[model samples]
Target: MERTGRMETITYDCIREAAARLKGAAHRTPVMTSRTLNKQSGREIYLKCEQFQRGGAFKFRGAYNTISRMTEEEKQRGVLAYSSGNHAQGVALAARLSGVPAVICIPTDAPPVKLAATRETYGAEVLTFDRLTTDREAFGRQVAEERGLTIVPPFDHPHIIAGAGTVALELLEEVPDLDAVITPIGGGGLLSGTSIAAHGWNPKIRVFGAEPKLAADTYRSLQEGKRVSIDPPSTVADGLRATTPGVLTFPILQSHVENVVLVTEEEIEDAIRFALLRLKTVIEPSAAVALAAVRKGALPRDCRKVGVILSGGNIDPSLLAQLWEREATKI
Candidate 1:
């Protein structure tokens, strides 16, 4: 299958190169399987556990892959990026590993644990913005220009997409016969990468994107055949609250993804609880979006073997109180 008019720079070759670059830097996070997951979904479910990834999320792959390739002068100048939380931690950690400085802009209301981890744990200079009022991309660019810092976009860059593709690349290498793959979409980095890797490995494999229904920008974009910006989401999945898809990623997702699954906040919370209680693992709400889709039968019935990426586990352990206030489920 010839992929014409697709992202030119992000091929299987590029993804393979990223895998090579990430060999030692990124953890080869395990492919997890559970009888309970299989029974709930009625399919052979392979869970790509990225919660165990460096920086406690898969964003480190792209952050390191992008920042590590910078010129010596650029590394000395350092990098700038904006995120709600996970990408900031990834960039801060990667910069530390590379012996460079990183400036991260995060939302003021971002999870306290994530904010602390980005600032104190990873040792990045942190800036806060009102996510509801400020445009983060514009703010990041302004700061980068003033400080002469290199910009590391959360997504929309070829290297980021290729780096993210490595997750699916590793998964397919371990489980080549999967009938479908699902990943949560936030500006489409992970989903686009997963689509490229999954289709590249086996063109027959189905690819799906999962999103919280409250933050249904990607869903609306796919329907209207262009990017759509919604009001800021009040969804529990804070990490997935992008109002629109990336300019580059939207096209890749439009081209390759089978469909986008929109799940409710309740379903997402249920998945979080399910993972903790039954699966004996921790997953944040954003990661739980993918699981909610699978466990709730949102995929096609023909998908007998499904692969799901549990994207992160950066939720504050205390957040369990807010999520399960009435119930007595303790982490």
Candidate 2:
């Protein structure tokens, strides 16, 4: 693990201000209750359904807040970003809403459904590169320089962290006495945001981060007492493929997050299937990490009130069919 001086740490006040800035721009996604989850887990569960958010993920809140806070000059130059799917859609839609042109750098291996949605629905320019050979961050920087586009990072930016904190803000508003809160971590945006909001609301509430075992950089980082990178991450959770934790999110997580738990790919798939079958909601693999943690006994058994952030719902129909068939065969 190594420390990078380039990263900016986000603060509780910063997140609060960012939430205020995103007041009308981002959706205050609902806190859904499930009797099935309660019975199965033996604890009251409050699911923060970010799947209902605009662009079908909590990434929208950060994107909109970050883009909206840009200078007029920055907006005039347009915006550029790199993402596998959710963040790409978030940045594209946010740019569109702000009347700014957007260019999204995507890996050639990105899901076809997500790529299509980003281009057709948001009208963003899609630039594809080989996932194995190309460095997306470098590509994004090159595009930004060439096109005069301001880079609105997916999770590393201060404004992005702040915007993401709003999810916890809304969640605690509905479930004030939550014993513990769990959220999936990618580049640490959502987890950091959740930490800020939960601790800010009530310091007694514990916040935990759930990560896929194959791409568990955050979990390793916390253990090593510094940031770590997991190159060529192998996992079904495409959205949590970030190799390095964000500079802005790491400090907040270190200060506020109580633990980081790892979930296997199989566990993630099972959680996704459980959400679809029992909750009747579509959740991406990354979003299901929190639920996977619970199902695997990563959370404390005595936690009376638990909150899990169900971060997104977008899934290719083919993948959905495959998952359903797999579940059926197992049954």
User: lDDT tens digits, residues 160-268, model 2?
Assistant: 8888888998888888999999999999989988998888888999899999989989999999989998786878888998998976678778888989999998899
Q: Which one wins on TM-score?
A: 1
Residue 329, candidate 2: Cα error in Å is 1.5
- In Å, residue 169's CA in model 1 sits off its true spot by 0.7
Mark the regions of model 2 whose C-alpha exceeds 4 Å error after superposition. Answer: 1-9
Error of 1 at 21 (Å): 0.3
Q: Model 1: per-residue lDDT, tens digit, 1-331?
A: 1345764547888889899999999999999998998987889999999999999899999999999899999999999999999999999999999999999999999999999999999999999999999999999999999999999999888888888999999999999999999999999999989999998899999999999999999999999999999999999999899999998899899999989999999999999988987888898899999999999999999999999999999997677767767347453
Off by over 4 Å in 1: 1-8, 329-331
The TM-score values for the models, in the order shown, are 0.96, 0.95
